[model samples]
Target: MCAQGTYITCANSPGQNFTGCACGQCAPPGCDGCVVHLAGGSTLRG
Candidate 1:
């Protein structure tokens, strides 16, 4: 899914080709999308 209302899960989307479907909970081997954009300090990968 990618028509603005983004979505891209399905097992981390071909090994981290991100888009927008990172369903529900976050932990235990589950993550493909998170905080981004940096100018001074901003980062969270998982």
Candidate 2:
């Protein structure tokens, strides 16, 4: 699971797993969606 204030995207395909903590405000290429942990204590799906 991703830690608070972070996001993650993964797949069965090779090299698709990525963590947003390593790239703030940037989503991995080909990523269709992600779960973002907000500072307001809520999760947003995009």
Candidate 3:
């Protein structure tokens, strides 16, 4: 797993990156974080 506060490069799109553990989710360009819905019905930063 990626450590918290680490920089993750977005795979779905080029030239995009985010701060924090994304769990493999891609963040949009220029976004520091992205919102993701969990299977348990909770929202968190991905």
Candidate 4:
């Protein structure tokens, strides 16, 4: 399981990173992390 404060990185969109244990679900297989916030100030988490 991922611990809190875990760093995340997306392959498709490099340079963009986020930190959150729950963010693991947003990331694709083999990736450390993915973008949870989307455009227009909307979030993917909810």
- Which candidate has the top score in lDDT? 2
> Over the stretch 1-46, how does candidate 1's per-residue lDDT look in tens digits?
3234343333344444344333344222455454322334433343
Clashing pairs in 1: 8-21
TM-score of model 1 (CA atoms): 0.18
Q: Provide the TM-score for each candidate, comma-separated.
A: 0.18, 0.36, 0.30, 0.32
Top candidate when judged by TM-score against the true structure = 2
List the RMSD of every prediction in angstroms: 7.7, 6.0, 8.1, 9.6
lDDT of 4 by residue, 18-46 (tens): 55434545465666435455434444441
Pairs that collide in candidate 3 are 22-46
For model 4, the superposed segments whose C-alpha errors exceed 4 Å read 1-5, 26-46
What ranking emerges by lDDT with the best candidate at the front? 2, 4, 3, 1
Report how far off residue 27 is in candidate 4 (Å).
3.5
Error of 1 at 31 (Å): 12
lDDT for 43 in candidate 3 is: 52
Better of 1 and 4 by TM-score: 4
RMSD of 4: 9.6
Clashes of 4: 0
Error of 3 at 33 (Å): 16
Give lDDT tens digits, candidate 3, residues 1-46: 5443455543454565455445445554554435543445455655
- Cα displacement (angstroms), candidate 1, residue 26, comes to 22
Question: What is candidate 3's CA lDDT for residue 4?
Answer: 39
Clashing residue pairs in all predictions, respectively, total: 1, 0, 1, 0
